[model samples]
Target: MRLDPQKTEFDLGYLGKQSQISVYWNLSSPQLIEQSIINKEANLSPTGALLVSTGEFTGRSPNDKYIVNYQEPSDQEIDWGKVNQPFLPEKFDQLLVKVLSHLESKNIYVQDVLVGSNPQHQRRVRLLTEYAWSALFARDLLIPGIDMYADGPDFTIIQAPTFCADPQIDGTLTKTFIVIDFVKRIVLIGNTQYAGEIKKAVFTIMNRLLPGENVLPMHCSANIGMQGDTALFFGLSGTGKTTLSSDPDRFLIGDDEHGWAQDGVFNFEGGCYAKTINLKKDLEPIIWDASQSFGSVLENVTFDEDTRLLDFTDSSVTENTRAAYALDNVARRVKSGMGGHPDHIFFLSADAFGVLPPIASLSPNQAAYYFLSGYTAKLAGTERGLGCEPQATFSACFGAPFMPLNPVKYANMLREKIFDHHSSVWLVNTGWTGGPYGIGSRIKLPYTRAIISAAIKGILEEAPSEYEPFFGLKIPGIIPGVPSKMLNPVKNWESPDKYAEMAEKLKAKFRKNIDQYKGEIDSELLTLL
Candidate 1:
């Protein structure tokens, strides 16, 4: 179905119904593509994808994101800190009035979508954006609204990219802000043109709201084998969640954002938003093909002046350059976007320190520990203002920015699910090896794929295993396709002494980061430190 401008309706409380605003409701993808070009908000790439530039901000402004501290009894459960920074409800109300006032007489695009794949625990979302391109991004990423005439949305997002916040008056850190009010079930975004802010605002909300219902929200990728064995790939940005899960032999459930229920895992998104910086056709053919499709949206990606051919290798625009396309754009995607309870889970990390093993199996206790630690390296250009040098990062559950509850809340859910489903968990390092970054080269993609293939084929289950004391991970002594030297990271290092030195340093850092959780979590699991 397509939008009917004549029949468009809205409430005056949030939006002035009598104003000269042109509200386009529920437009189809084709309509949005055509409108975006006509409005000159975006251009058409040579590959037929919609191309748009998110000026100034190409990545999320995490520090600017605030959660309104309404002091509701339920909000007392929220673990508030720098990541889940608090905002005054009075400030939020003032900002809402200003945002709604700014949109009074301007053209806006509205969309209704669903956030969760499982109908049993889905959220009805209503999105209102100032740009047609942003509306298309939301429509392509989230499930289309099922009941067009349904009642009020469970959550509403009002985004005005052009409206700048007054730091002095708004009590904000910058001219841009992303504020989420759980009590009001509303999110307000201003001054940032980044479309990811819209998608992630909802994700952060889900990460906060879902755990209370016993549904574990995750920042991971999932795929299923022909026999219905589901596997999850967990990692931070640049850790290869999108790259590894696009396996030709498997059916992809989703590339990011999923929920684990009592029955199984379900994707939260309807499409894949993949990083496209320095992308090579031979390296990641699945993502390359999807980026060239008709209905895709390319953000901050540049093309040749005459040929219009994308220069994926170029980082002049930003390394966070991205491509958004429907899940069906990929050849081997699961149609239902639902999978059996994950039988296997893989935690991926690009260990810049080069001390962790390339691949290691984990016991239930060890899995809980590492899962809570959620260790990885943040590559340069992955986020706004990040330098070229890789920096060590420890985000709980691999997604600290989105997690509002205590880390133990998520860790407990993962422990319960793994035991209930009898799932096997493994830690895979897709990062540098032999030595730290600059000294050692990154792990080859082919080798990483082979390791994952063996794990999925059950090759590692019965293989000879060796335990590493520092991280407490069980290393598989031998695998059919992988090199034996690569099995243990320390073996390939130039100096065994230096390797041991670095390993001990990382273990110390892990302890320091999780010390705050000691009183709240299982003390036995912390012994893995």
Candidate 2:
């Protein structure tokens, strides 16, 4: 196998010195795009974004993910259950050998990047992928310009999309597998072309490791106002974390993952991996324009074959369509990718049940309660096996699949940070209102934007608020540019009695879900449920 003459001076001996793999190290976005097209792995949109299909798997397969249980202190700390499933260390080693053997005689792409923007807490990562576009995805989503690591990467991801695991022999649930060994500081992903697994695997490692260093790793988007006030938006996929945080008025700190240090909050990524299903130029001009720019990677998005024109509204392939582009593509992004401690935090929930208020203020304990609850509808296409209808689900910390440690650990850290920084927390519902899913219309984007803008400007703090007894949330009576009637969710429904019934049902769900954390959390906080 021939190696690229421009390959960095880093050693590939750890992967196997005997393997004759052609390594293409640290290729630029344009070069990667060229390779992608040449390899028939992707096509270019009219505007130059690389368009590729993720094949059968368009979303993450949570059940297929695992963490090796052999690690000493780290393995014992992992929340060992379905989300943080345990895999045999020997099995992992066997699978890694097989995956590396599969890559032999094939071209591989390597990218050395940093996970955190702040140098003090940044994690060095070395990503190896079988596809050029996959390497580009990593480069686009991670901090680049790391020529070499002095002591090797803090974590190394080996993604072999074409290499499938044998469930019976490999100990994986399926042919697709994502196995991370914390002790080894290595991640192995097989039989999944879904690029999200690559990004999320890195996040999972950070979630597991950051708490030890006293840095709170978060699954949220952050942006700063003109006055330099930072705001955080937290939610699972399809709940508007990306859309809400990409405010035209504010400079985007990061779109997805972040780390809150004692000094400030820093982005975990150098780019935004935004959901593009039904994206419109007028509503989300920044993301829309970025999605169409050169060097961007559009995954699972449909386009006109002959014309090479992208149709953002097309969801025939999947509603989980995504665009991965560097932060430079966004004009209103923070160049440093860091922000002061967040002054306000928004917990975004697409309440398909339509019982929750559009926006509500939370006390400290209530913040912890709701943070642990992390309620949202499992939107269609966000995960595999979900139908078109939305299903209500609770993901602790809004990212249960990625969080390896216990939910209580992150909750406690968040509460401590809030107390130290005096940050205000608000619950924002970007989901349906007036009624549940099909019967009700989604809360308008402009109205939600208005609510957030008012909150950022401190308009809601002084506004008259009414007690929402069901969940004990403080609902503002009015928000600037938003209809007063829309503030209270029950009033928007046709039948108050039906609304009451639904509210009671949802309240019961919150209680049932939080029951797991009964002894773990403050008992007084449970009363808020």
Candidate 3:
């Protein structure tokens, strides 16, 4: 409500500008709703409707009203290269009195407040809050209007909620922001948090507000568990990242997002940001309970006091229906059980394209090749669960959207990690068998889970998984549950023409990406493809 808070500014000129996409959102704040109405320059779409408290996003949701609010070109708006400079609450030292003068009455219960940022955007406030600071009425805040430009000079104005926090209070800053001016490669977005089961797990995620680290942090699902010592799982929004990771037999480390550290991998938050859409009690019971907690923030679920129930399928929260809750929501929580160098890095390809196999083991080079060549197709509205129409897309990583590092750099890391850790990674196609994506049904979640579980267990490397020499691994047994013919795309499909055409198109796309990496990758890795 007030803009006069004296704010401490961070000079994040590390990554440069125009390289990253920045976000200024609160974990849970009414101010976000307020900004939509107040800031005309802040480019906001009613996308928050996906995060609204009302039924605007519920079933039968009308066509999107997400009109871009800010009129500035993205180039001038987001500076991916600048680091997130988080100073002491000194942020408001200059504007405090002015800001304080503006607020009529925010919370009389509040007294003191402070601010911080993560230069690398690798740290999280909520997860470490218990280990650090002391405050009253402390909550995440956002200012959409000012976010259109840089935070340092032009407008150091930060729209933070006034929290009565004590700097001298027992804890140090819960979140610390720093710059990683190292190599710009090895950065991939979305996967930073959601890729689980057997991933290059990075838990201590979400650093500074806009620290340009040449990397991107995104939201999705992930799973990884050691079988003979290895973890791996992959699923898109509806595929089953949650179902597979909830395996009772595994020593469940934190699920969802994590960060990489010199000491291995650490979970970013104490929780998981799970989708509650059409959430089935039989499948996602854990997320259901986690969504109701005080600290838990609901994205776009319809909340009704009279019913005391959340209609998760309601798009009002987000078509995603997410719940950001501590991973502790599960009884068997692993504070830091993962991050051992991956012995098997699996990249899941939910190919609505329907041209790939049910599962294909790969050599580190092949793995790297595919990882950088993220290939998949979306089923007709399966992404939004409507008849919206299917489409195809490819990225260096399953999550190219949030990657702060370069594709080659990340591929190099995967190569190095695979070799150093001797990991066995794979590219599993959970797409179609009988036909290409649109006409065929997606592989059943249960069957997909069985295959993934088997893959983690080395079952794929056992008997039936015929060895593919170039791939550096074996394709094993059909693990009783799934239809035997479905295991191989060639067998499951009645026609190979469609599969061939799709494969050719993908290969051409892969070839087009070749020149981009010709100079970055090693000769041998390049030769593998």
The candidate that achieves the highest lDDT relative to the unseen native structure: 2
What is the lDDT for 231 in model 2? 99
Taken over the whole model, the C-alpha lDDT of each candidate is 0.88, 0.90, 0.42
| C-alpha TM-scores of all predictions | 0.96, 0.97, 0.60
Clashes of 3: 87
Off by over 4 Å in 1: 1-7, 14-20
**Cα lDDT tens digits for candidate 2, 134-193:** 999998898895576767788899999999899899999889999998877889998989
**Higher-scoring candidate on lDDT, 1 or 3:** 1
Off by over 4 Å in 3: 1-230, 234-243, 260-262, 292-295, 303-305, 314-318, 337-339, 377-387, 466-474, 523-529
Across 1-529, the per-residue lDDT of candidate 1 in tens digits comes to 7553442756645332344445888888888887888889988887678989999998888899999997888888888988888999999989988898898766788889988988887898999888888888998888889765356888899999999999999989999999999878889999999999988998998898888778999999999999999999999988999999999889999998999998899999998899999888898899999977987899989887677778887889788899988887899999888898998899999999999998998889888888899999987766677887889999899988888888889999999999999999999999999899999889999899999999989998889988877776789999877789988888989898999999999999898888878788878866657
Task: List model 3 lDDT by residue over 16-61, tens digit each.
Answer: 3222222232222334333323432112222222122312222211
**Deviation of model 3 at 196, angstroms:** 18
Q: Name the runs in model 2 displaced over 4 angstroms.
A: 1-12, 16-20
Best by TM-score: 2
